[model samples]
Target: MAKTSWHELPRGVRDAVQRELGGVAGVEMISEGLSSDVTFVAETGLGRLFVKGARLDDDLKARQLRREISINPYVTHLSPEIRLQVEEAEWLIVGFDYVEGRRADYSPLSPDIPLVLDLLGELSETPCPEIPLRDAGRLRESHARPEDLHRFSGDALAHTDLNPGNFRITSDGRAYLVDWARYSRGAPWIDATAFAMCLMTCGHTPYDAEGIMAALPVWKTLEPGDLDAVAYYQSAMRSAWQPRLDPWTNASVAAARRWFDYRVGLEVGL
Candidate 1:
């Protein structure tokens, strides 16, 4: 593989992998997550494999690498194939059988919206064996404020970043959610709301409040108090970050800020 700077990788961690996994025939950096880097294909003597890399210094990234390897065995038959785990100096490397898929586009919002929602539901319902619930306190320390904790609801594995680019749509129409570094235990609605926020940010206004309502019917099942908790949690989360996200992701964050302020009746703007 050709040596490249870290920033050249879409996910920003491929340089570390190439340095450690030498003689890699081919390398394609795929997605950069909040904490980890992903490559669509990495060449090994045997064959090409999907690889993800992260620094051990990032607690979340390190934990997620371990989680992917641990949970992968149980879900291999149920979901995608997780191949192996290789530890390279200062970096955790994970390999998976390459799944053929393409990024979903934002045009024709009708089907994609519901499709992503269904994908999240399926992932959340998958049988995870004995993984600890994500520490809400730790997340609060990383991104939330004190008031955010009071709004905590039930916990489940949430794909915190669900922007359109993060989803891969196979030719068979199966949707795979990649980039697991931000995977955390949180209210299920957080993912739904985050998805909704992304859609709106991408200029797909065809789905309005009613569309968000329809996709996440779980909100209706919640008691009035529970609904309040979900709203606060989502609002606080929507406002939690101001860092430099991927170029495509910035619009989504701005839209989320607008929606959050509108809902909470606060002037907080991104």
Candidate 2:
């Protein structure tokens, strides 16, 4: 998607956001991420803020933006704080505190994994917020085996998308999660499973990645059959949602295929 420049927004929308920021001194366009219609850094009298705006007319973007804003109020350092929401005309703009940090790396051997894992463990323990979120099984029902969907139910709030870019590591060496757009209510293990797949993208074999996450308490109760179902379901989903063939994407897809094939191979009598 193209970056919707600050000047492209309606006068009323821009004015509204300015008021919320106590008068915007200047605005810098943010050119990352596909979810936002207009993402920019606003230098305001109050301070610098990261603003992500989306036109309310685009149904999918609107729904994602609204869901993220709704969930923002409930999140702490787990995500950026929602300080202002400017709603006017066909636009809805949200401004968040801009954290000074860098994107997390998930390479074969990076110092970030331990901190990322700790964040995953802690976030999984967080109680689900009081909001309508995607139910795990139901989210994948059309593509998943019936038995696989059952593993998704639990009280934990899952940030289902674990792209390294969504994680921010501050100068103090603390990590914070960003982008609650795909936040959902599910079992704690759901997020871990997603990260387990991510670990594979970082070059860990499926079994080895699973071992890395064995520190999570859910492992004590998780069954191999349960993992089998999840793997099949994810493999199917990946097969359906095609991405542009770049090195990273190809590598990610290959990892998914390898994991799926490995798990499926283990199901001897099924």
Candidate 3:
């Protein structure tokens, strides 16, 4: 998606940001993420802020923006704080306190692995706030067995997308999970499972990924068949959703299949 430049935004939107931040000194556009039409960091008189938004006319993006804004309060401790919000007839923009960090590396030997696991441990213990969030099983409802969907139910709040880019590792080894657009209410192990998938994508085999995830407390509470059910559901979901011809989607599908097959092999004592 081509990012809309700072000047391309409506005058009303620009004015709102300037006024809210006191004054804007400079603007740096961020081009990595595809969810936002306008994403940039504004150097303001107050401070630098990470601003992201989409036009109100784009229903999907608009809803995602609103959902992200609504979930900010609940996740502020582990994520950035929402510093400003601009809602006009044509646009909805949100600004978060700029976080200085590097993208987390999920490779097999990266030291960032432990920091990521610790973040997940904290996230698993976070209480699910009372807000409208999608149920985790909805992603697998069309593919999972009817009897197994209940296994995904729990009061825990999970960041369902555990992609490495979504994690920010600070210089001091603190890990911050950003981008709550896909957050959902689900069992505590949902995050651990997602992290395992991410590890697999970064060259960790299924057994190695599971071994890494074992450090998280949530990964220890699974019943006899929980891992099998999650792996099966994740594989089914990944296979069903890889319509886009992209490297990321292709890699994810292959990784999920590997995980599901590994679980199945374990079941048969292979």
Best by TM-score: 3
Model 3 agreement with the true structure over 19-85: per-residue lDDT tens digits:
9999999999999778888999989876988899889999989898898998999888899999898
What does candidate 2's lDDT look like per residue over 15-106, in tens digits?
A: 88877778998988879978888898888977888988788888888888888888887677577787888889899888888899999887
Model 2 CA lDDT for position 242: 72
Give the runs in model 2 whose Cα sits over 4 Å from its true position: 268-270
The candidate that wins on lDDT is 3
Query: TM-scores for all candidates?
Result: 0.69, 0.93, 0.96
TM-score of 3: 0.96
Checking candidate 1 for backbone clashes, the offending pairs are 11-32
Error of 2 at 33 (Å): 1.2
| lDDT tens digits by residue: candidate 1, 97-201 | 777777766554456555666676676576435676575446655445554554444565566767666687777777777655455666555566566666667
Give candidates' CA RMSD values in order. Answer: 6.1, 2.0, 1.2
Q: Enumerate residue pairs that collide in model 2.
A: none
Deviation (Å) of 242 in candidate 2: 3.1
